[model samples]
Target: MDELVLDGNAAAGALAEIYGDDMTTVLAECASCGRVDPIGGLVAFVHAPGIVLRCTACATVMIRIVQTPSRTRIDVRAKRIPPPPETAR
Candidate 1:
């Protein structure tokens, strides 16, 4: 089967739905390559199993989200999850 792909920005809505807030603006560092970038800048792929967000710099898997009938699992261990961006007053 063909693989589908897009930048991480496209997953904003889905991530927000799961986290109850906007997450696209958050920065994350690739654990493997140590290249930091916004979560919105990573590469993303959506498939039958779930969503996969990868580091654009090194192509390392940064985040994987799987949603089942009863629960959602997000694996960010391979990523350095950043705090939410500062709000503008």
Candidate 2:
């Protein structure tokens, strides 16, 4: 069976709305493994609740985005990588 996953670029639209920039090209230095790569290279898991982006090399969660009726929450692990803006909601 095919896997239900996509590359990090899949979340570009949502991220663009949050960052006000093209995040796909942003490099992220993984806190777990110290691998640096474009955010677009991470693995993306999209679900009803939110979106989760994980490292391709170490599989560590890079970011999590959850949107509610009244608010949007973005949790990021990599220090150099910026999280979605609060105004994204």
lDDT of 1: 0.74
Q: List model 2 lDDT by residue over 39-65, tens digit each.
A: 888889985479998888888888888
RMSD of each: 6.1, 2.3
lDDT values, one for every candidate: 0.74, 0.80
By how many angstroms RMSD does model 1 differ from the true structure?
Answer: 6.1
TM-scores across all candidates? 0.78, 0.84
Best by TM-score: 2
Per-residue CA lDDT of model 1 for 1-89, tens digit only, reads 13578878877876775667878878888888888888888889885488889888778889887777776667774555643223200
- In terms of lDDT, the poorest run of 10 residues in model 2 is 80-89
Task: Give the top-scoring candidate (lDDT).
Answer: 2
Candidate 2 lDDT (Cα, 0 to 1): 0.80
- Model 1: what TM-score? 0.78
